[model samples]
Target chain A: MRYFNNPEALLRLVSSMQEGFAITLTIFFATLLFSIPLGMVIALLRMNRHRAVSVPVSLYILVMRGTPLMLQIFAIYFAVPMLTGHNLERMTATILAFSLNYAAYFAEIFRGGIMSIPVGQYEACRVLGMRRSQTFFYVVLPQVFKRVLLPVSNEVITLVKDTSLANVIAVGELFRAAKNEASRTASIEPLFVAGLFYLIMNGLVTLFFNRLTQRMSYYRD
Target chain B: MLEATHIRKSFGDTRVLKDVSLRVSRGEVVAIIGRSGSGKSTLLRCLNDLETVDGGEIRIGGQALVTMQAGQPVYKKDGERRALMLKMGMVFQSYHLFPHCSVLRNLTMPQKLVLGRGDGEAEAKARDLLAKVGLSDKAGAYPCQLSGGQCQRVAIARALCMDPDILCFDEPTSALDPQLTQEVLGVIRRLAQEKRTMIVVTHEMRFARDVADRVIYMEDGVVVQDGPAQEVLGDHRSDAIRAFAGE
Candidate 1:
């Protein structure tokens, strides 16, 4: 409330979000960069008929999806070293946890996209002499990405907010920065101001997703 | 030329094609006609090795589809199946154009990848094909934007990109509106004029009557009637074909 007492204090609150915003973007961009390919790999693994591939992949998906992201952050931040008997940094643990957690979700999305395509497309590729890799890259994946973008963009927008959760493990991200500023200055107004910050980032991501939808609109059946 | 002997396929316990034998000589356009679920499509797939046969063999351009003469697997090595599929192009009932690529890109990909034709050369050829199919104005459009007939013509143009000797059609006009059906029929007639060897499976009796060199009527996965189009559709012989023609 004291921060809201003056224009300069509010200005301080706005400026304070910069550090948290950067951390937010870090988690946002990093999750997209890492999760897409990893999700595709996991998707392919789940598609595999062999128990060696499917069982473990399904297990990963089960554990990640069955639990909340909050629990996962806690586990990776705490349980990893206990099990592996190794020391780890907090930021690294957050990223590892978030990437894997989202990957399981994105894998199901990718599989749905792949499965949604008509079977004749595969036959078309096969009879056209496209090799497996070529068929996938040229024919299958363009479609998977097209089908997946909306759901993925929704997740990405969600990721922007989810990065705030990293503050639980002391990542010094946007939310953490705001919390630090608020505690130091003895003001709760920074928290409300921080919510406004998340909205802006989410708004920009929504526009980006609109553009993606425009590009993919052609691929719709 | 292509030949198949005792081609058999079954999904689980339900056998689709039982001891199916077919032979196609050079420059022959054989039309296979049948009711729904009569295995007309499966036979075409078997001819092209799109579906693996449980017990039989298909040879296209002197290459076996299921197994080699050595009795090992066919396409045992990488690129073997690709090498064979390149010689023949198949047109599906639903025009399976790559949704992401434009019509120009659709026509160019197979040329560049399968025929090793460069992009510029393929584009020029694609333009010519688009012109040939009366879709020159639609070259910039994607498959989804086109009508079903226009898409089929584009599919034909895309298939022609490879300069294949054999073209296979699976219910080419079944999905089109009546006015659109004539557009595709015109293209098929033109292909006949160009002496393009083709195998078309269709329910359009009039198309089989007008375009086929020889019409083979399939009933219960077997050819019940095989003769010149005039004889086959112009007062056909077998009771099965008679009933199939709704006589």
Candidate 2:
């Protein structure tokens, strides 16, 4: 209560947590950067005709989605080093685990989007003599993006909170900093401040996605 | 300009097209009319390589798109088939306009991507075809903003932008309201007047009678009658065709 009453202490608390906030943001952005494109490739592979290719991709998605993300982080951090005899940095393992888990989710979302397009769209491209690559990248992908936007926004917001899971592996992320400060000060004020930080971050994400949705507003089914 | 012989297609146990054959000369407007599941659309699709024929031969503009070999249909090599397929353009019943693209981009992008036309050439051709379809003002508009009839006209214009040697319409106006159907039929009438080679699969008896030079009627996947449009529709000899023509 004394620390909560002191404005100077609150200011210090916020400043001290800035590094953890930065690490959280880094993990969030880096995960999106790597996972989104990886998800698209995985979606394509999952939709492949060959069972050998699609079945393995399906199993990968199943494992990632079925398991807890915290366990995944632990496996990457502890088990990988034990098996490979080379230790991964805590940050690297956290990012890798988040990316792989998120990519499975995004792949399923993208596959649904791709499949939602009518067969007529592809037939139109075919009769127009469009090459397969041109048809997919130009005609199909834009439509898929339009269809998948809302679900993707939901997943992205979930990812924001999921980033806090990184503290399990002691990655020094935002939640970890708040927890440490709360134990030392014996007050919950720092944790409240961390919640504010998360709200601000997700607020920006929501704003960005809203703009994207508006830009595609002209497209209608 | 287009020929198919013994064209047979099957979907699992059901035979959709059984030994269907057609021959269309240059600049001739041939209309194929049949009931649903009569294989009219499937035959048009086969001519355009949208669907592979199970057994038969399809030749467009003296280029063989597919030929029968070992009791199965063999398509030309990829590049050769694509080149041959480009000789024809198709307007679908649903319009099938790329919903994300502007009306102009729907016409222009395919030209630029498939034909490697420069921006200036593509835009000029797109504008010309849009004007031809009486939709010059809608170039910047998206497909969703247009009425069903207007979308179909844009689809016709998109096909014409390619300067195809032959054009195909798969029931172009069947999806439209009766009022909207006439506007699209008017566009097709104009194209026929221009002497463009076109093969149409349609349900409109009057449009087929007035616009088509030749009418081919099908039933249960076989051509029931093939003759001049007046003779086929006005044929007193075949009761089935007379009933189909609403005589």
Candidate 3:
């Protein structure tokens, strides 16, 4: 209470964080909304038996997952567009880096879930005369979703916290705002406030996923 | 009618099926039994092309199934696979009731996807099937929320929704508790009474003897005994079958 002499100061502080919070949320949610699907596709590609299809996909996944996410982020943010000359903006580059990073991780989770399903399910689907695609989508995908939820949720939570890392590329997410506030006001108090903000956002995300789990509890496989 | 001339399959040098073959009429109920690793399940799966037979020719209703082809040989197994699949319903050892969908949706998915039934018609058919299985009250429940028996009943309702001519059960009662098995077995027995064509691979000799019209006994993938359930179960002549039933 003593740290804040007036409500106006608290209001300004919250408002300052809001601009970055929006960026943080955008990076987090957009990465998830896109990456989960992309990751699943990437995972499927890796699992493909044909070397022409699976080899390159497996190499791509290995490169992304094998390296530290931070290093990949820096490489993609700094070097990716230069080779192709896409000239992406800071926020866009940050999002792209985050998306690719999480996609690799989510791909593994998807693969694990797909692999964990009893082979009998596929046999059962094929026995019923389902096409390969139909069997994968109808019989196989539902089970994978049920199994991969927890691992994917963990990656998502990690992504939310990882948004802070985007500040390196001047994306101006939560931690960036805190840094600005700390230096401008010459107070470490604003830094603690931003830390609290991270906890709140992570907590909210955890709650959302918990609710999702309940809705899907009906499907064991 | 179904005719499998010479069905064969092997797994990594460990042969599971060996030149096995049989025939079933349009309304026949064939029960397959064997000791573990005798390829009883493999034979059933091969008949449906679930397992690619290494060497064989299968004909369903006069169609050749070695390639899932069209016309000639009525291989209800090849290009005929999809429609044949629609015409055939399957029950798994672990009741695969499409856990993602509700009971009604589970029943309708095949009708809509495979049978090309309209949503309205599929819904009606699903409801009817659910009623037939005595699960109309649980139509909204997902597989997880239901007991093993209820889930299996839903699985049956789902298969029946497609109006398949042949219903295959792969050890349907193997995974269930004794009480739950009775419920599932009762549904299957009722289907048999309605003159439904069924091919079942099971270890339950009692059910096979009680419900099956014809019984086929296999050893190392070849049929060693084929006759009426009573003859095979009671009049077991082969030492292998006698040994199997401990007679």
Among all candidates shown, the one with the greatest TM-score: 2
Q: Lowest summed lDDT over 10 consecutive residues: which window, candidate 1 chain B?
A: B68-77
> On lDDT, who's better, 2 or 3?
2
Best-performing candidate as measured by DockQ = 2
lDDT of 3 at B118: 94
Arrange candidates by lDDT, highest first: which order?
A: 2, 1, 3
Global lDDT of each model?
A: 0.84, 0.93, 0.81
Model 3 Cα lDDT, one tens digit per residue, B1-247:
7788777689999999888888889878999999989999888777766777777787776656564224222234345566655555778888766767788877777677666789999999989988888888998887889988888888888777767778888898888899999998898899999888999999888999999999999987788889999888876366877789887
Residue B229 Cα positional deviation in candidate 1, in Å, after optimal superposition: 2.5
Q: State which candidate, 1 or 3, has the greater TM-score.
A: 1
Q: Write the per-residue lDDT of candidate 2 for residues B1-247, one digit (tens) a residue.
A: 7889999999899899999989999989999998999989988988888888899998888888888888878899999889888999999999999999999999999999999999999999999989988999999999999999999999999999888999999999989999999999999999999999999999998899899999999999999899999898764547887777566
lDDT digits (tens) for residues B1-247 of candidate 1:
8887777778788778777788787888889999987788999987776877777777787876565456533543556766776778889999898888899998988778767888789999999999999999988888888999999999988888887779999999999999999999899889988888899999988889888988888777666777898888876466777787788
Clashes of each: 1, 0, 12
Error of 1 at B207 (Å): 2.4
Using lDDT as the measure, the top candidate is 2
Runs in model 1 lying further than 4 Å from the true structure: A83-85, A218-220, B67-78
Candidate 3 residue spans exceeding 4 A from truth: A1-10, A219-221, B67-79, B235-239
TM-score of every model? 0.94, 0.98, 0.89
Inter-residue clash pairs, candidate 1: A20-A174
True contacts kept of each: 0.67, 0.91, 0.53
Residues A1-221 of candidate 1 have per-residue lDDT tens digits of 57667899788678867877887787878887898889999999999989999999999999999999988999888998999999779878888888999999899999999999889788877777777788888889888887888888888888888898898888988888888877887877778888988898889999988998897786556
